[model samples]
Target: MSEEKERQAANEWKVGPVAFISLLVAILFFSGLFMKIDGMKWLSAFDFTTLGGTFGTMKEPAKNTFLGAGGVSAKAGFLFALSLVPTVMLALGCLEIFSHYGAIRAAHKLLTPFLKPLLGIPGLTGLALITDLQSTDAGAALSKELYDQKQITKKELVIMGAWQYSGAGLINNYFAIGSALFAALTAPVIIPLVLMFVLKFVGALFVRFVLNVVYKEDFRNEQ
Candidate 1:
């Protein structure tokens, strides 16, 4: 009976991880397709004359102000893309600060009790799971830490990979790039965002369901 339990646990671990990674890859590929089809050329279509006057013709505009005495340059589109750089840099810096302070560890402890049973993951796995929601790199780093500590098995890592891939760091991308596309195309911004969220939610649930089905016998034996 003990042997059967061990086997079942192992199988459950394997199924979850495998399904997670596959779903993540699919989401990324589709996101790329959506971006390409949404008309990204608007970034280069700004006209400075429409704003007020040509660049360098305006009086000194304060750094914080968008418009000058002559008017704002027709660089709205370019400026929007440029804005993403600072946001990304800020996110990376914040992540580093969080890691330095061991904030992830504290978060893990706080989340572990609730998540461990539901996800069938180790207490520390919470850190990686939450980080995955924020950013893929952060999640990957956390996963590696857990793996190195022997806190999670190969199967668990695979599941984390799948989950992170699906929509990890997606919020930033949506606001930065996706929003830009919506503005350019004059499309209903809420629709695409909602659709993407629904797809990701459904995909994650589907993957979890498949894992449960595939490993049901093993899980039952474990119980």
Candidate 2:
């Protein structure tokens, strides 16, 4: 964590009820739950996926924009990743507004008690980690933003990457793809999700331990 950033945020905003509420709204906005509902499409207005929308198909339904269907290898991968640029930009824009109002600071303060102790990363990173549950691209973008702002150290960034990479976009990927195999599985659907979520923390902690023990000299100057 960057001490300067912490002090700056502390001076900029007082963590209060409004700040807390703002953080809640920001979290829900990216959580994907509100993107669609059985009978309530209006809620999509507040959802990140809905707000980000999707790329339009050209003549053929599968061929969207320059990236056509049945593509493979690195070229296809790059194009697929490129499509997420819009959502990432939009998420960062929204985050800036929330941060301006002190929601990000409040999130940092509120999550500090656990996040600092558990992962040794700044509490402000909670937003990014939570976002990963729904959108991997957005979470990664948020993490990059934090690093670019000099808010988290390189070690902290590595720890966060460990947490995120464990089950990147777990909720979205699981529910979307796993639902098809739900009937074939022996266990309940929620069980696997719970395990994977827990493992994200475990993986982060393990990485933290390794960094402290094996690579301590690399970050000797950092806190």
Candidate 3:
């Protein structure tokens, strides 16, 4: 490639870890983690009295119990988030283990014929793509591996990007959060559940179409 072309390629490929950190910080700020919202009372409608005792009698309990409970809840949330860190690390570790055992290679061989034609992605890309469904950072690291190994070209990476950009592992998220947190029988649950699946399917299809269009020439060459 020419120097100009190389420079352009380098400029196009950039990862902004700081941007991700900033997003987390912003979410914490807005979610009343750092500062409470003015003039907004939380859980004001909760009928604690139904459990027994008037508001005045409950004042001490509310102050002591509620505050203590709030601390526990916050700690639990923090721990939940922390728990993901190790899970993610373990996932990446497992990926490495699979790679070492030749499982990934076997999977690539088994899946290539089907995926190559339908998605225009190499069979090997499937491993990374699958991992991406579990974790974005992990998927990204796998994609970087493919790039570094010359298994996928830069142009092909762009095409893959289209498909990977949309939310992956949505089904897992739905089951983990939607079903687990809120009982499936909760009021009007079916509609939201169905809608989430539909949206995920549509989003995946849309990305496939866009990638196909964007990489039409490259795909044609492959054909």
Off by over 4 Å in 2: 1-10, 55-78
- Between 2 and 3, whose TM-score is larger? 2
Better candidate by lDDT, 2 or 3: 2
Residue pairs clashing in model 2 are: none
Q: How many residue pairs clash in each candidate?
A: 5, 0, 0
Best by TM-score: 2
TM-score ranking from best to worst? 2, 3, 1
Best by lDDT: 2
Compute the lDDT for candidate 2.
Answer: 0.88
TM-score of each: 0.43, 0.86, 0.46
Task: Name model 1 segments beyond 4 Å from true.
Answer: 1-105, 184-201, 215-223
lDDT of each: 0.51, 0.88, 0.53
Expressed as tens digits, the lDDT of each residue in 152-220 for candidate 2 is: 999999999999999998988898788899999899889999999999999999999999999999999
Q: In candidate 3, which residue pairs get closer than 3 Å at backbone N, Cα or C atoms, i.e. clash?
A: none
Each model's Cα RMSD = 16.1, 3.8, 17.1
